[model samples]
Target chain A: MFRYLVRRFLQMIMVFFATTFIVYALMYWTGGDPIQALAGEKPVNDVLRAQLTKEYGLDQPFLVRYWNYITDLLHGDLGNTLVGRPIKDVLADAWPITIQLAVIAIVVTILFGVTAGVIAGIRRGSIFDNTTLVLTLIVIGIPSVVLAPLAQYLFTIQWKIFPTTAGGDASLWDLLLPGIVLGSLSVATAMRLTRASVSENLRADFVRTARSKGMPGRRVIGIHVLRNSLIPIVTFLGVELGSLMAGAIVTEGVFNIPGVGYQLSKALTTEDTPLIIGIVSVLVVIFLVANLIVDLLYAVLDPRIRYE
Target chain B: MTDIHVSSPPTVGGGRHLLEVKDLFVEFHTRDGVARVINGVSYHLDPGETLAVLGESGSGKSVTAQAIMGILDMPPAKIPSGQILYKGENLLAMPEEKRRQVRGKEISMIFQDALSALNPVFPVGWQISETLRTRAGMSKKDALNRAVELMDLVKIPAARARIRDYPHQFSGGMRQRVMIAMALAMDPKVLIADEPTTALDVTVQAQIMDLLGDLRRDLNMGLILITHDLGVVADVADRIAVMYAGRIVEHADVRNVYKHPAHPYTEGLLDSIPRLDSKGTELATIKGLPPNLMRPPTGCAFHPRCKYAKAVCTTETPLSLDLGHGRTSACHFAKEMLDGTLR
Candidate 1:
C-alpha cells in the first residue's frame, strides 16, 4: 500500500509538469502583454515603463520568463496578478467556494444517483424504474444551459422559492437548484453508470448465489448488488468530479457566484495571466487530489485492486 | 426435490418428505417470445438422498433447480405451474417472505462457476459468515469461528489462517470449497449443487466429490447434485434423474441407472464415455443438438437424436415405461431396448 501511494505520488508529479507545460503554452499563445494590462492603456512615462519592464522581467526572453515562473513555482510561490495582488491569496479565497459547491453537488448526486439506480435496476419494469429512466434521460439528453435558465425561471420567477443568484448569505436551498442544474450532467452520468453497473451485477453468478441463499430481494440488491456495482460508479464520479469543477466556471457565470470560475472569466476579460494561471493551478491540484482519492477508494472497494 | 436423505439433521423432527416438486414448469419470454422450458417435472427428496439431475446444457436441469429454490428470474423466465413443497408447504403458494425464510435456513445452492459464484470484494470467510449471521443469527465472532470450522469441513488447507484471503487468492478447487462452506454455514436441510465440480481438474473433482459425500453423510442433508458428467454421478448420487429437453428421460436408483440405462439418451451418454477395460477405435457420441424448445418435435424430444427412433417415436410421445425394478424410461421401444434388439 505504501509502495502504491509513493508510486502514485511520483506519477502525479510527472502529470503536473506535463500539464503545466501544456497550460503554459496555451496561455502564452493567447497573446496578452501582462505589463500593459497592469500599467493601464499607456505607460506612465518612458523611464517609468522601462523601470517597470525591468522589475517585472517583461522584456526578458520567453524561455527566461517560463524558467523563472517554474523556479518560483518550486518555491511554493505563484506570481502576482496584473492588479498587484498575490496570486495565491486570490486563488485561495475563491478555491473553497468552488470546492464546496462541487463537493456538495457530487455528494448529493452520489447519494440519490446510486439509490435511484439500485432501485431501478432491482425493480426493473416497475413505475419506479420508468420514472428514473425518464428523468435521467431528460436530464442527460437536454443541455444543462437550457435547464439552467428554465429552472431559474420556473423555480425562481414563478414559484418565488429559490434565490435566482448565488448571494453572500445564501442558504443551502439557494444553491440546491443551480447545483442540481450544474451537476445535472454528472447526476445523469452517475445514475446511468450506477444503473448499468447494478443491473449487470444483478445477473452475476454471485447474485444468483445470494438469491439461492434465500436473501430477500432488497438485501440482495442493497448489499450484494449495490456495493459491488458502486466500484465503477465511483470511478466515473472521480473523472466527472474534476471536469465539473472546471466546467462550473460557466455555471458560476450563469449563476453569478463568486467562485474560482467566476473570477476566471473576469480574469480572462481583463487579461490577468497571474490570476488565470493561479485558478488553473488550483484546479489542476483538485483534479490530481480527486484522482488520488478515487484510486485509494478503489483499493478500499476491492482489495484485489490494492497495489501490493 | 427428492429428500430421501432428510433424517432431519439428526435430532430435528420428521418434516414430511422435506421437499417435493410436482409438475414444475418454467417458460422463458425471450426476444423470440415465450418458450416452454421445464415440462411437468416431478421429484421428491426424503432426508439424506443425493439425487443427481443429469443433462447437457439447456436441458432445464439448472432451471428446475432454480425454480425449486425460488430463485428464477420472473420477467424473462416465469414459473407458470409447479408446486415446490418443503416440509409439505407449497413454496410457490406460500408468501414470498415465508419462502425466503425457508431459503437460507432450509435449502441452499452452490452454483456452477466457483470464481464467479463468490463475491470478489469480500474475504471468503466473511461471505460464509454473512449467511450465518443473517439466517442463523450468529454473532460475527461466532459466525467467523464456525466459518473456519465449515472450511475445515470442506478440507480446505490451513483454513483458519486462510479465511482472511479473497476469492482470487484461492485456486478453483479451493474457491469451490469456500462456496460449499458458505452453503453449509446455515446447516441447510437440502443442498442443491449445480455442476459443482465441472470447473475443477479431474483430481480436484474427485477430491470435491469425496468431500461432498463425506459432508452429506455427516450432515444427513439431502443433496441434489446436478451435472452432465455421468462418471462423477456414479459414486456420489443415490438416485439419478436424466433430463432431456426439460423432461426427465429416465429416473431411477443410481446403481440401476448405471447398470441398466433404460432410455436411449442415457444409453447414448453411457456409450459415449471411453471404457478403461476395452478400448474402442473411437468413443461413441450422441448426434445432433437437443431440440429447440420454441418448436420442439411433436413426439419425444429425444427421438430426433435417438438412433432407434421409430415411426411411433416420431408421431407420439411415449408415456414413461415403468421398468418395475425401480426404474423408468421415456421411450416408445423400451421393450426392444430391454431385449437388446434396438441399437
Candidate 2:
C-alpha cells in the first residue's frame, strides 16, 4: 500500500512538472512582446532589455526555462514577485484565511447535510423528506453568488444577526457568515446526494436483513445505510472544496477576506505573472491533495478497496 | 444430515407451533388499482420443518414473506385481511414497532443477493454483530464475540481474522453464508429465506441448501423456503405449496404434489420442468405469462395457460377443497383427480 501511494506521489510530481511547464509556456513566453509588458513602457534601450531578459532567463527556450522552474520549485524557491516581494511570502499570508473558511464550511455542511439526509431517507415520503427535497432543489437552483448576497441581505442586514461584510478580525464568527453563505448551496446538494444514496442503500437486501435481525432503524441507517451512502457525499465535498477555493474570489471580495482569491484577483488586473503563477501552483497542490485525501478515504470508508 | 443437534433458540414459541399464516391477503395499489398479489394464502410450520413456497415468478411467494416480516414496500402494499400468527400472536394486526421487535428476534429473513444485502463500507463483523447489539442489547465486546461465533457457525474460516474484512472480500457463496450466520445470530423461531440460493451457481446453490437444511435441523427452527425453483426445493421441503397468479393452486406433501398434482396449473408447472427422460423433445411451456393481477381474467386466472382447462374453468373461480390431513387444493376436479376418476 505504501509503495502504491509513493508511486502515485511520484506520478503527481510528474503531473505538476507538466502543468507548470504548460502554464509558463502559455502565459508568458508564447504571448506577444512580454518584454514591453514586463517593463510597462519605461522606455529602456536594447542593453537594459537584454539584461532584464537574461536575469529572468526569458532568453532561454521554453523547455529550458521550465526545467529551471521545476528545479527551483523542488528547492522551495517560488521566485520573486513582479513588485519584488517573494512569491512564497504572498502565498503564506493568504493561504490560512482560505483554509479557515473552507474548513469551517466543509465541516458544517457535512454535519447538517448528512444528518438531514439520513432523517429524510428513513422517513422516506414524510413531510421532512419533502421539505428537504424542496430546500435542496432551491439551494442548487440558484448560484452561490446570488444566494450569498441575498443571505447577507436577509440575515445580516435585515435581521442584524451577522455582519454584512467580513472585518479584519480572525475570530471564528468573523468567518461564519460567508462560510454559511458559501456552503449553503453545497449543503443542499450534499444533502440531496446523501438522501438519494441513503434511500437507495436502505432499500437494499442487507438493510432488510439488518432490520429482520432486529437492528433498529438508526442502526440500519448508521451502519448498513449511511456507510454506503457516504461515497457520493465525499465526491461532492471534494468538488465543493475546490470551487469554494476559486469561488472565494467573489466571496472574499464581498466579505473583505484577503485570501488566495483576493490575491489572485489583484494579480489578474495588474498582470503580475509571478503572483498569479504562485497562487495557481498553490491551488493545484491543494486540489491534488484534497483529491488524494478523498481517494484515501474511499479505502477507509470501504475496506473492500485494496491500495495495490 | 441425521444428527438432531438442538439449538436453544431465544424465540418464545410456547407449546403450539412457531408460525401460522391464516388466509393472508397482500394487495398492492399500483397506478391501475389495488391488485391482490397474495389472496387468501395460508400455511403453517412446525419446529424444524422446512416448507417451500414453490412457484414460478410473480406467484406471491416473496410478497407473502415480506408481508410476514412487516417490511413490504408500502403505499402500494396493503394487507387488507390476514393473520400472520407468530407463536399465537397476530403479527399483521400488531403495532409496527412491536412487529419490528418480533422480526429480528423471532423471525429473521435472508435475502436473495448476499453481496448487495450487506453494507459495503463496514467490516463484516460490524454488520454481523448488528442484531446482537441492536436487538439483544449486548455490549460491544459481547457482540463482537457473538459475531465471530456466528461467522464460525456458518463455517467461515479464520473467523477472528476475517471479521474485519468487508463484504467485497468474500465470494458470493461466502457472503450468503455470512448472511445466514447473521440471521441465525438472534436464534429466530422462523427463518424466511427468500430465494436464498437463486443468485448462486448450481454447486454453490446445493451447498447453501445443504447448509440451510443442516442449520434448520440443528436449530430446530421452522424454515419458510421461498423460491421459484421446484428442483431447488425438492430435497428440502417436507411439503410444497404450488402457487399460481396470487393463489395456491396445490398444497400437499412434496411427494404428493410431485406425484399426483390435482390442479391443472400445478400439472402444467410440473410439465414445464424440463424432463431428462424426454430428450430431443420440445420442452413444455405454460404458453402465456401469469395474468396481470391489475386486471385478471373474469374466472379462473390459469385457464388461458392450462391444457386441461374446461368450459367451467373459464366460467367461475374454483374453490379450495379439502383433500385430507390439512392438505387442500384449489381446483375444480381436485376430488376427481384424487379419486383417479379424472383419468
Candidate 3:
C-alpha cells in the first residue's frame, strides 16, 4: 500500500504539472496584453510600456517566464496580480469561501439525493421512485446558468428567505442559498448513480443470502445493499468535490459570493496571467488529490481490491 | 423392485412431516407473459432424510427452494396456489413476519456458487454470526466465537485464524464450507442446499455431498439437496424427485429411480451419466430443449424430448401415477416403463 501511494503521488505530480502548464499556455496565447488592458482609455508611450512589461516579467520568453513561475511556486511565492494585489492574499480569502460552499452542497446532496436514491432503489418502480426519477431529470435538464438565477430570485426576491447577495464574511447562513444552487445538478447525478447501483446490487446473490438468513428488511437494505452501492457513489462524490470547489462560477455570480469562480472571472477580464495560473494550479492539485483518495477508498469498500 | 404398496405423502392436517410442498404452482409475471415455473410440484422431507430435487437449468428447482425459504420477490414471482407445510402448518398461508421467524430458526438455506452467495465485503465470520447476533440476540464476541465453532463443524481447517478473512480469500471448496457453516449456525430443523456443488470441481463435489450427508445425520435435520448431477445424488439422497419443464416427472427411492426409471426423462438422465463400462460408445443425450415456460407444449411437458412419446402423449397430459413401493411417475407409459416392456 505504501508503494502504491508513492507511485500515485508521483503520477499526481506529473498530472499537476501537465495540467497547469496547459492552462498557462492557453491563457498566454489567447489573452490580450495586460498592460494595454490596464491602460484602458489612456495611451501608453513606448518607454512606459517597456517599464510595465519588464516589471511584470512579460519581456521574458514563454519558457523562461514559465520556469520563473514554477520556481516561485516552489519557493511559496504566488506572484502579484496585474492590479498589484498579492495572488496569495486573493486565494487565501477566496478558498475558504469556496470550501464552505462545497461542504454545505455535499451535505445537501447526501441528505436529499442519497436518501431519495436509496428509497427509490429499494422500492423500485413505486410512486416514490417515479417521482424521484422525474424530479432528478428535471433538475438535470435545466443548465445551472438558468437554474442559479432562478433559485436566487425565488429564495431571495420572491420568498424573502435569503439575502439577494452574500453578506461580507460569507457565513454558513449567507452561503446556504448559493450552495444549493451549486449542488443542484450534482444532486441529480448522485441520485441517479446511487439508484442504479442499489437496484442492481439488490439482485445480487449475497442479498438473497442475507434475506435467507431472515435478516430484517431494514438491516438487509441498510447494511448489505447500501454498503455495496456506496462504491460508485463515493467515486462520483470525490470527483464532484474537486469540481464543486472550483466550478461554481454561475452560482457565485448569481449570488455575488466571493469565491474562486468570482476571482477567476475578474482575472480573465484583466488578463491577470499570474492569478489565473495560480488559481488553476491549485485546482489541478485538488483534482489529483481527490482522484487519489477515491482510489484508496475503493480498496476500503471492496476487499478484493488491493493497492499493491 | 419391491412389490409392497406405499401410500402418498400426507397433506396438511393428515400427519406431520419435517417439510412438505404440495401442489405448489409458481408463475412469473414477466413483460412477455406469465411464465409458469413450478407446475404442481410436491415433495416431502423427514428427519435425517436427504431429498434430492434433480433437474437441469431452468427446471425451477432453485425457485422452489426460494419459495420455501420465503425469499422470492412477490410481484414477479407469484405462488398462485400451493401449500408448503412445515410440521402440519401451511407456510404459504402463514404471515410474512411469522414465516420470517421460522425461516432461519426452523429452516435455513445455502445456495450454489458460494463465492457469489457469501457477501464479498464482509468477513466470513461476521456473515456466519449474523443470525446469531440479530435473531438470537447474542453479543458480537460470543457470536464470532460460535462462528468459528460452526466453521470447524463444516471441516474448514484453521477456522480460528481464518475467521477474519474475506470470502474471496477462501478456495472454492472452502467457500462452500463457509456457506454450510453459515446455514448451520442457527441449527435449523430443515436445511436446503440448492445446487450446492454445481459450481465446484468434480472431486470437490463428492466431499461437499459427504459433508452435507454427515451433517444431516448428525443434526437429524431434513436436507433438500438440489442438483442435476445424478452422480452426486446417488450416494447421499434417500429419495429423488426428477423435474423437467417445471414439473416433477418422477419421484422414488434413490436406488429404485437409478435401477429402474419409470419416467422417460428419468431414463434419459440416468443414461446420460458417463460410465467406465460404456467406453468408446457415444454418450446418450435427451433430445430437444426443455420447453419454454411462457409457451409450454400441450400434454406432457417432456413429450417432445421423450423417446417413447406416443400419439396420446401429444394431446393428453400425464397424471402423476402411483407405482407401488413409495414411487410415483408422471408418464403415459409408466406401467410399461416399470415392467421393462417399453422400447
Best by DockQ: 3
DockQ by candidate, in order: 0.77, 0.69, 0.84
* Cα TM-score of candidate 1: 0.93
- For candidate 2, the docking band is medium
Error of 1 at A174 (Å): 4.3
Candidate 1: tens digits of C-alpha lDDT, residues A76-106: 8998888778988877677666767777788
Weakest ten-residue segment in model 1 chain B by summed lDDT: B1-10
Count of backbone collisions in candidate 3: 0
User: Residue A237 CA error for candidate 3 (Å)?
Assistant: 1.2
Q: Judged by lDDT against the true structure, how good is candidate 2?
A: 0.81
| Rank list by lDDT | 3, 1, 2
B13-56 per-residue lDDT for model 1 (tens digits): 54457677888889999999778999888877877889999999
- In candidate 3, what are the lDDT values of residues B111-169, reduced to their tens digit? 98999999899999999999999988899999999999999999999999999999999
- The Cα error of candidate 3 at residue A163, in Å, is 0.6
Q: Give one digit per residue, the lDDT tens place, for model 2 in A29-122.
A: 5455556766776876999889888988888887787778778887999988777899998777787788888888888798888789878977
Task: Rank candidates by DockQ, best first.
Answer: 3, 1, 2
Would you list the clashing residue pairs of candidate 3? Answer: none
Superposition error at A85 for model 1 (Å):
0.9
The DockQ of predicted model 1 stands at 0.77
